[model samples]
Target chain A: MWTFLVTEIMFFGGMFMAYIAYRHAYPLAFAAASQKLNIILGAINTTVLICSSMTMAMAVHSAALGKKNLLILFLIATLLLGGVFLGIKGVEYHDKWVHHEVPGPNFEFEGADAQHAALYFSLYFGLTGLHASHMIIGAVILIILIVKASKNQFSAHWYTPVEMFGLYWHFVDIVWIFLFPLLYLIDPRK
Target chain B: MSDHIVPVRVYWSVFITLLVMTVVTTSIAYIDLGPFNLLVAMTIAVFKATLVVLFFMHIKYSTNLTKAIVISGFVFLLVMVFFTMCDLLTRNITAPGR
Candidate 1:
């Protein structure tokens, strides 16, 4: 699990480096692009992810304690929070689409350095899109775990899957921990 | 293998702290901190990531080998960033001759 996560780190690290390089090259454009993000939605999603991480951690703890019902409950809560996050993300994407911020021919940016601003949105979509896909994958895994949890397939002696899933979920949460600030809070105008 | 079972209270407290930091970060972003804006934002982000990694991910209770592996990933990423930035930041823009 650690090995897989390390690889995932390297995967995202390259994109993060791209983001940093562009931000350094086009600070004003990046800041302008960031100002267009919905800070409220981003903050809500961050809170949701943090809550889900808590539930995931609790699920692992419950599994470790052999509390079958509590484990299931926390798993369900985590799934619900993950779903909420994806829902909010969808809304944000849809809003960007309506505003013509998808970084294509129809993409629109006003003022000088519009091209550089488009680069910011491109990186934004790339990073957040990858992060959202990971969340979707985690949600699906939580569903499988929920089914097995309901069957009492886990116990204090053998809850490796639960612990592993907890690690994965928290890793996703941490990615957003960085993403929220880097992508959303750079320039919270109003 | 018996793993450490963190108390429910710790999870709740960490969750609250994360939310508080989120709010603090958002509030600070609106205050126009000049050049300190990015630095302050990244500092808070690193702090939040540390909380999630140590508490939620249980790396705090994990073995030294696990901790070493995780830290090494970041170290490798830092090396990549350092080399890339060296190339990016040291370029001569006015050199027209090959």
Candidate 2:
């Protein structure tokens, strides 16, 4: 898991570098682009993800304690929180799609240095899209775990899968933790 | 395979701390700290991440080998970021035309 997270770090690290370089090159444009993002939604989503991480951690704890019902309950709660996050993200993306903020010919940022602003949206989609994909996968894993946990398949002696999934879910939450500030709260103009 | 079960109180406290930090970060972002804005935001973020890592992920209760592996991941990430920034920030200094 540690090795896999390292590779994931390198993966997201490159994009982070790109974002920093572009933000450095076009600070004003980046700021303007960032202002268009919905900070409230972003904060709420951050909280939701954090709560999900807590629930996931608790699920692992429950599994470790051989508490089958608590494990299933927490797993279900985590799954629901993950779904709410994606739902909010879908709303944000739909807003952008309607506003034509997506990076393409239809892309438009009514501000100085629109070109770099477009680059901001590009990274925005790339980073959040990847993060959301991980959330989807995590949700799927939680569903499977929920089923197995309901069947009393896990116990204190053998809950490695639950612990591993906790790591993965927390990692995903960590990614969003960074993404929230970088993408949403980065408005220098505010 | 030493399994340590963290108390619910720790998890709840960490969650509350993370939420508080999130609020603090958002408030700080609006304060116009000049160049310190980014630094402040990232510092808060790193702190929050540490809380998550230590408690939520149970790295604090992990074995020495597990800790070493996790620390190495961050070390390599630092190396990557540092070298990459060095190249990026110094590119103009060694430009062929300059």
Candidate 3:
């Protein structure tokens, strides 16, 4: 699982590379575009994701303790939190769509650096879209774990799946920890 | 069953620390630190990531080989970014007359 996560790290690392390059090239435009994001929504989502990570850690702990009911409960909590995150993300996306902030033909930015600002939106969608998909996948895996857990398939002796999934879920949370500030908090004073 | 079981209180501590850092980073972004804004933000972010990787991900309890693999992944990532920045940051600094 650690090996797999290494691959995942490299995959996301490529996109972060692009983000660094573009933001360096157009700091003003990136900040201008970033200002359009709703920080309140972003911060709330961050809080949700962090809470889910805690639940996920507890789930893994419950599994290690052979506490079946607690494991299932924590798993469900994690799933619900993940659901809240995606739901809020959907709201943000809809807001962007309504305002034509998405990077496409209809995209509009009322700034001198409209073209470069569009680049920021492109990375914004790419990074967050990919991260959201990971959460969706994690949600599905959580469902599977909750089912297996109900069947008493995990215990102190063997709960590798739960631990591994916990790692992935925490990884996704860490990605958001970085993304929140990078995408939403840029030049907030402005 | 040789796996190290982390205490629940440790998880709680890490989780609370993460939450506090989140609030700190968000609030601090509004202060206009000029070039240091990005630096401070990224610094806080890296610290947060390290906490997650160490505590929630159990890298702190894992075997040495596991530790090496994880560290190498990030080291390679930094190498990629460093070399890319080398190219990009130098692209505009051509010879004096060129």
- Candidate with top lDDT is 3
TM-scores of all models?
A: 0.96, 0.97, 0.97
Model 3 agreement with the true structure over B26-97: per-residue lDDT tens digits: 898789888888888889999999999998998898888999999999999999999999999888686466
If ranked by lDDT, best first, what sequence of candidates would result? Answer: 3, 1, 2
Clashing pairs in 2: none
Model 3 segments beyond 4 Å from truth?
A: B95-97
Expressed as tens digits, the lDDT of each residue in A55-86 for candidate 2 is 89889888888999999999999999999999
2 or 3: which has the higher lDDT? 3
Question: What's the ranking of the predictions by DockQ, best on top?
Answer: 3, 1, 2
Per-candidate Cα RMSD to the true structure, in Å, reads 1.6, 1.1, 1.3
True C-alpha contacts between chains kept, each model in order: 0.81, 0.56, 0.80
> Residues A1-190, candidate 3, lDDT per residue (tens digit)?
8889889989889998999999999999998898899988998999999999999999999999899999999999999999999999999999999999998999999988999999999999999999999999999999999999998889889999999899999999988998998898878565
lDDT preference between candidates 1 and 3, better one: 3
Superposed Cα deviation of residue A39, candidate 3 (Å)? 0.6
Residues A27-127, model 1: lDDT tens digits: 88998888889998999999999888888888898898899999999999999999999999999999999999889999998857889989999999999
Docking class of 2: medium
Each model's backbone clash number:
0, 0, 0
